[model samples]
Target chain A: MSRAYNFCAGPATLPEQVLLQARDEMLDWRGTGMSVMEMSHRSDEFVEIAETAEQDVRDLAGISDDYAVLFMQGGASSQFATVPLNLLGNSASADYVNTGIWSEKAIAEARRYGDVNVVASSAGCGFTTVPDQTGWKTRADAAYLHYTPNETIGGLEFDFVPDSGKVPLVADMSSSMLSCPVDVSKFGLIYAGAQKNIGPSGLVVVIVRKDLLGKAHVKIPTMMNYQVMADNASMFNTPATYSWYLTGLVFKWLKDQGGVSAIGELNARKAKKLYHFIDTNPLYSNPIDPRFRSRMNVPFILADEALNSAFLKGADERQLLNLKGHRSVGGMRASIYNAMPEAGVDALIFYMAEFAKERG
Target chain B: MSRAYNFCAGPATLPEQVLLQARDEMLDWRGTGMSVMEMSHRSDEFVEIAETAEQDVRDLAGISDDYAVLFMQGGASSQFATVPLNLLGNSASADYVNTGIWSEKAIAEARRYGDVNVVASSAGCGFTTVPDQTGWKTRADAAYLHYTPNETIGGLEFDFVPDSGKVPLVADMSSSMLSCPVDVSKFGLIYAGAQKNIGPSGLVVVIVRKDLLGKAHVKIPTMMNYQVMADNASMFNTPATYSWYLTGLVFKWLKDQGGVSAIGELNARKAKKLYHFIDTNPLYSNPIDPRFRSRMNVPFILADEALNSAFLKGADERQLLNLKGHRSVGGMRASIYNAMPEAGVDALIFYMAEFAKERG
Candidate 1:
């Protein structure tokens, strides 16, 4: 069997080893006589799988016992509303840092629940870089500050974690989590849609500081209540069990690769190699400033506009799949997520050089 | 690969054909060179999959164009909250027929959204039967009538759809959907958690009459809004894609077996055969009234209570898996979902008879 290097953002590439491992166990898991899909969520077998995933994630992140790891459904978009619902508490306002499309959506959803103060915004600069922290107007009385560390659409990323002072820092890390090392204690909460750099499309991994629990507005749905989710250990209802199982496999994969720090070094190298090719090529140009360029999603444009379609077609023919950029920015993007091997990056660079040489 | 017949109540049994089909395609789906889990939801290939599943469901249920089919996450428990948040429009109270634990939970969740009236309750009968419709105190002013057609834990099912007059009839068919033929036109909405008879956990299927749209309260989250879901065809957010694909396969499996009607007949026969053994044996008894006994889940108790542990152990040794009942009920239950072949029922009976003969 052959596999293509998939670079579509969000529901992007997964480790081939994990997929093969899952395929081998598709019919029966550990002599259980049924697939994980067929096992009850309350069963001891499944509970062990869920608990092990939780412990592994905590260990990978060095997450303190003060934090709760919730394996939830409805993706990160759902958390746009869930964050405000669970964190706004009795406070009248929440502060938001707008970086790109993802942060804008989060800001808009938070407004539905409470007053939102735009503490920082890079939209004024055409989403090219993270605005300097000194220009921001942060509120002391605000419930929490929210931001997206990596904007998958425009390929912009924050190089530094914001200092929230006394306020809890909340971040939508959908495109960036588990890609590198992170300081768990630096944020009040972190959330990610598990389609990118994680497992499947429908699940979300939410890590909320335990102290933030039980403060949701009385009217929010139980499924969206972090406290309730934490209390139940994220099994508030039948979770996306299959996704959780796959994610556990992924956590083990990360561990086998020497945890997040080692993966971070490799991820940095992968991004550096791909960007080096794009930087030196006459036919290709990456628009974002070097400081803010994302490692996971790299959106590059062609010097000759008409070659865009041909470039993508040629890439596909060569079994380099899903390299088309986001529609809003019509060019080409190779999202080199953590699952992408360095060899895949080398292949991408080889193809890009050949394409540029032929076009030039 | 040896496969066991699993009788688990929720994340219960799935069709072996579906499992085999999924296993074969796990590495490369339809030569796309990527697993379905890795494909973008907006990609033509994945969208075709999502559309085909919707169409197949509409075909299987004989659903009309006036109804919208939504593939959602968070299970039936989330829908307990979603139902009221979406359907409790311009009415002070919603009516709920309390049959068992599921209805109890639904009633509690609906009260969080609006006034809920227990129109009829079988709780007085220790949840052994459904309260007759004639005794119901259903309100004409109610926005809708809610009921669970099959209670998985209690093993009671409503054999007839409740008449809500002008009020929209909403039914939770989680454990009962696809097990029988039903008149979709009879109810304003039908929803089923896809674990039992459909596919996997985490995906919930909702079929709603189109007119019910545009009435949800403004405070409701966009993801939970039926109007938004209908407008987006349930790709309002990235859906449980893999689960949706497997359900499509299960739909095809049902169609191959002559659709829901034929499956309904087989399900009835399976339940009847299992019930016959329990009824005839001096060592066993089924508590639920025959009229309310679920076609999908059969809960039976042993006359010699001390033999319960031994009965389950022996059954497991004989390969009758998950015959252990709900934790709340504490007896034995065999969830004969659409995936369970009649041969499985025969094996169950064979074990039950031998165990009884040895014990008696």
Candidate 2:
């Protein structure tokens, strides 16, 4: 019956209330006599659940009718190819900004389809900072400009949205969607794998500007076609029904917590507290530039790298689980996404301070 | 909580025991203090879960290590493209047998990736029967010969596996996988969307012979590339972890019910009972050829079409749910998946007979 503070990034922590609600309704949703997972995607009840989840995203983020909200499957990794396959239309090239591992992945996938212009990259700086937009080399005839708003593994984020002028701005916001509100009209497309700020690992929420719908490559896989997905309302296939239902519950839970604006403020405060502690503590160090540090994923290294395992073992004992950093990065990471409470942040800070005092 | 008999074709029905166990583990899975959905894919806990699920599928289906089992996403629709993109290799064409809607859809997606020579089709016969394999005009030079063992929509199932000689035989077992045992060594690949006979939607299990690995078209999306999935043990990206976990639970439940052989006997008996009643009853008829009718999905029509609504309403009243057939093939479809209990089938039969007596 006890729940720990789970800090795993992507398939990350979900609101406890949402889990309890899902648990309560897992056997039979309301009086429907079946679980939401058991309901057909085309059934009136499931359609309502699906539509309500989409509408909630729109309401929470102020998304207009001009954009098509698609509940897609295959996570953000699928969208890596989907973006180029759908957006690259007749254009021979697309513009990309490399922030970290996720952006690099997007670039690699896009290369399979068309020419990619790396307009900006933080690779030179060890993915510690977002390159200044002023020094960028954006393509004039690029199909779309793609960027990762929040790099989950690198603990890097864009402090300001890049203005692409008339060119459409496409963002992979897998780790940051709904942590704050963004002006939906500014982007041609926005996609997030639901595992982090949304729901589970399989479902992804894609918001594409209506005008950008049908420009898919001729050879685009039907399941990967944005236009087809929008036309069919994201039920191009059976959809990840249970994941979508859980996402709806999350959207409802987010609304109950005063929508994105309130949650954003809370997220900002949580990230700031953790970063401020890291900055002041003698035994902990975060390498990212303060201005571009991510509010969702916060990676830090102990003053002594040799003590990493003991530190993590201690964290696990305290039930502050999944503090181990990604294998690519050798330190510890605490991904305090929207579901991660400020209390969890305080607990993390408490553990960090205690670990520092003992190991310093 | 009262549970109804759900006859939904896919996302159809799940074993009650699986749901109960999932509910109990919703908050804290095996004292891990987080739900399986919250666990990182790379974590020891979730990896164990993922591995265990894959192992169970191999055990239940009697698959040898010669086949690389991939837990993938985007459902069977995605696989429609994935199959051709990965398997087509240097071949100019792939041979396909279209028996029903799902087969036709698969053929359609494969056409985008390569030339799909429909070796045979039952469309002229109104998709009521499987085209005899003896008369199939399969290509000798084809990369693979594909067929649907059971079509969820038209209730048509191949009575025997198509012999493609040296051409690797591929089957979409979406609705029939684990409903019976099949000789895994006979086919190059077998795939099934977890929703029907496995678990929830959004997860597709692919069993590809190891030789089929590394043959994906260069343009194939990384997520859709079977080789990449197998190489990474299906963790090329964060998979549909929750769905995979649920599928594992179903596999365990299947084992407890005495494996595929025992369930195959039950499934056959259930289908025979329903088909026999329809044959003898004055008010019911199934258009599909009885010899090739699906054991997984039983589609029947009332002798008087006017009584369809009344029949469904009464069935709903009796806690028999989702009996409505696919919109494309309107009548009634009671999908008796492995999870659909014998008692539920009996209840359905009793209801059908009573309705016929009252209205015929």
Candidate 3:
């Protein structure tokens, strides 16, 4: 079977070009006679691969020397605990803005370590919209202000970065990172699990300010300590070397496609096309607020609930896989990350139109 | 260049056949129209891949129904802290044997969570031998008794499993798991970083007795909680799916090569052949006690340390790579994990003999 336009929420689609290169180099990488997975993390060759990847991400993201870019394992979920352990040094409380499921998860995990003050929440609205920042009651002495830039499950996204005053701003960009241009200087730390816009599932890229180092709680596991990881250049242990290498390939591919600015334009166009079709077509509806709808994951529902399965079946037949919405919210979600070509979006739109005409 | 005999310790060699299979399936896995890495963890195709891999490992290791196998991230180093965080529920301390660097590191990390009682130590002998179990001063009240079954860097291994009696026994089998068959019923938990006998880094296979679940410290991170992970079938969050899939392929390959018992016989033969050559040759020497020498990692030194560069240079020219010893212990180390075939061993020995004959 030929490759399909995968719409998985995570472990999502990668650029076809990147997958081709990986397949070609699976046996022997760069004439080294070893796959990247087989190479010692400390070897000169792997170090170069690691370093090149770090540099490419840094270049693409416009990260500066003031921040240390770490390639970590266990994804953003691990960082949920790591952020509080590292950033909540002497502070007894931290602020959080609960936008959706991801935000609530972060809030719950943060409560395990220290006081988590949910300065604002969108639960009153059934998580279809982001709460206005003007209504938030953030604390000045809070260690860090945490929020989900994009919630993968709920298809809710923050259209603006919340200002934290003196407190550091930390964003879990797992679903939406690299889909568009992001300013590195605005946040104390920014993290994205590689499965989304990056590469594979096991690796998470953390961009943290240099000053936010060495303040982890005493009981924090060494691996969770951002300081130790940053010091070792994220090679504190054997990393997901293959995942890291693949992520590097993605960063290079993004560069070749004219960096985040160019990809952002393509992403915006893709999201606009799909959302436009959903709104104009009488048979489909999306609950998310138009202003805060995720550009990466667009969740929509069929006008007739009975037609959900048929809509999905037709989409699958046309190679638009994993269009099923998250189980929590029963409908359909089309996750068109940076790797999903515009043609793929066009195909999905075409399928949705045909299904609506025949069934709706 | 064709594949070289990669002997670098962890993130070590993989079976060539496994790499080839992964290459062939990189773009589309089993006609799913998506790479395994791109599949949702909850998707039927990925779930099947995950389940098959889990079942294969269980069969290969002879794990019983009483054990819950967890595919975790952050490697064994993460497990060092996780063991104590979860198991040290009410106990004040855990018993550990300080065999070498790996043991010392585990002990050091375990200490941060609870009192660690070093039951025995081979540090007095520069870690060349394992301390006898009879001399160990283990505490009956200890939360668990932890030991490094095989030390990758020191090239030392325990010839016998220690009798922890009522206390659950934990072993870090990162380097020697599946090299030989072992009775899983005796262990409370067995953890291995999956870069050695298993495939790739960033994935750790944890086999834990079912009774040990649900007893974690209040402050334990959700990701580090054993019960949470077990209850979710190691899908507490999106796991290292691709790594887990590759590891499953390796396990299938192991079964194809006959089970652990057959591999054990082959492993013994390979170790014996390599050690026999090192001991008989006047120019080469291995300091480890013959009985305790690691079958997986054989660290040996040249009689004249000055010939080290020439030895490595000649070996590399012949495509025998990563033979250099760890920087902490600098001579030469050959990590012949299960994936390193007998032919690779023969090639290495042939090159070693030729180098000694010409340079001696």
Best by DockQ: 3
Off by over 4 Å in 3: none
Error of 1 at B190 (Å): 1.0
Question: Candidate 3, residues B1-360: lDDT per residue as tens digits?
Answer: 999988888899899999999999999998889999999999999899899998998999899999999999979999999999999989889999999999999999998988999999999999999888889999889999999999999999998988999999999999999999999999999999999999999999999999999899999989989899999989989999999999999999999999899999999999999999999999999999999999999999999999999999988898889999999999999999999999989999998898889997
Please provide, for model 1 over B185-288, each residue's C-alpha lDDT reduced to its tens digit, 9 standing for 90 to 100: 98888899888888988899999999998888888888889898888978877887888888899998989999999999999999999998899998899999
TM-score of chain B of each: 0.98, 0.99, 0.99
Residue A284 miss distance in model 3 (angstroms): 0.2
Residue B99, candidate 3: C-alpha displacement in angstroms: 0.9
Show pairs that collide, candidate 2.
none
Could you tell me which 10 consecutive residues in candidate 1 chain A have the lowest summed lDDT? A1-10
Point out the worst 10-residue segment of candidate 3 chain A by lDDT.
A308-317
Query: In DockQ, how does model 1 score against the reference complex?
Result: 0.73
Worst 10 residues of 1 chain B by lDDT: B1-10
If both were scored by lDDT, which would come out higher, candidate 1 or candidate 2?
A: 2
Clashing pairs in 1: none
| Residue range A1-360, candidate 1, lDDT tens digits | 379888889688889889988898889999888899999899899999999999999999899998989999988889999999999999989999988888988888888889999988888788888899998999999999998999999999888999999999999999999989999899999999999988988899999998988899999998889988888888878888999999999999989999999999999999988888889878889989899899989999999989988888999888898889887777888898889889888888888899888885
Residue A334 lDDT, candidate 2, scale 0-100: 96
In order, candidate lDDTs are 0.89, 0.93, 0.93
